[model samples]
Target: MRKNSIKNIRVNEEVHRELSNIIRGEIKDPRINPMTSVVAVEVAPDLKTAKAYISVLGDEQSQKDTLAGLRSAEGFIRVKLAKSINLRNTPEIKFILDQSIEYGVNMSKKIDDVTKDIKED
Candidate 1:
């Protein structure tokens, strides 16, 4: 199957949703911040591997801790995923820390500050 096939897209969405639910409700690791969110999920066409983009709404330490926590819980997460979703092969999840949301917010704040200065001038 092609990379952008309909089936592949559906799988990605299902994996994304299940992952979010598992992380948000199932996991009991204190290292993972309560503000953590799953930004996206990409499952390979073959379903052998997947990448989960995570975002933590906290300091750098919290982000690192969250990533570490997720990595440590990968096996458990995969088991949960397999049980929750009837996939042929449960993909090995690779957690990736995503800072896009934080970056966008920072950029927006900078832009607002510049605009305010312009108005004052």
Candidate 2:
């Protein structure tokens, strides 16, 4: 199948949803921050592997711990995903730290500060 075909898109979305649910509600690892979120999921068209972008709302230590927790629970998460989604192959998941949300927030704050300075002047 083509990379951006409808079927591939659907698979990516389904995997994304299931992964979010599993990470947010299913996993009970203490290392994982309660504020963790699955920002995005990209499943290969071949359905053999997936990259899950994860965002943790915490300090560097918490983010590291969260990533470690997720990595350790990958097999369990894959099992849960397989049970929930009917796919020919359950993709191997790779967790990636995504700071886009945090970056955006910081940028917005900087812009606001600049605007406020202009208003004061």
Candidate 3:
């Protein structure tokens, strides 16, 4: 019931898969960017709450708008997830923006620049 038990891991994966599907196909908010992807999901052992990490591809404005859209549709998303999963109590959906991809890209670029400089030397 704590720290990534088998049951908790299974539940997390289920939530992640179902949420990705719902977000991709069901959400209709214009603010929600088409590039938005559910990268990860962390479901509490009690199943009362879950945090869904989303990666929004695009500029800052687009990412912000997509997050706003997701927050606005949280209730509807929760309902759909509950129905799909057949859970007695649907976990509250909390959307978190995952900026690790961007960070990684930036770091890679920096590394490339450093390597190029080294080669020139």
Model 3, position 5, has a per-residue lDDT of 95
User: Which tens-of-lDDT digit does each residue in 76-102 have in candidate 1?
Assistant: 999999999998899999999999999
On residues 50-115, what C-alpha lDDT tens digit does candidate 3 reach at each position?
899999889999999999999999999998998899776799989999999989999999999999
Error of 1 at 82 (Å): 0.2
lDDT of 2 by residue, 30-106 (tens): 99999999898889989999999999999999999999999999999999999999999999999999999999999
Query: RMSD (Cα, Å) of candidate 2?
Result: 0.7
In candidate 3 the C-alpha lDDT for residue 108 amounts to 100
Count of clashes, each model: 0, 0, 0
Candidate 2: where is the Cα deviation over 4 Å? none
Q: After superposition, how far is residue 32 of candidate 2 from its true place, in Å?
A: 0.5
Give lDDT per model, in order.
Answer: 0.95, 0.96, 0.92
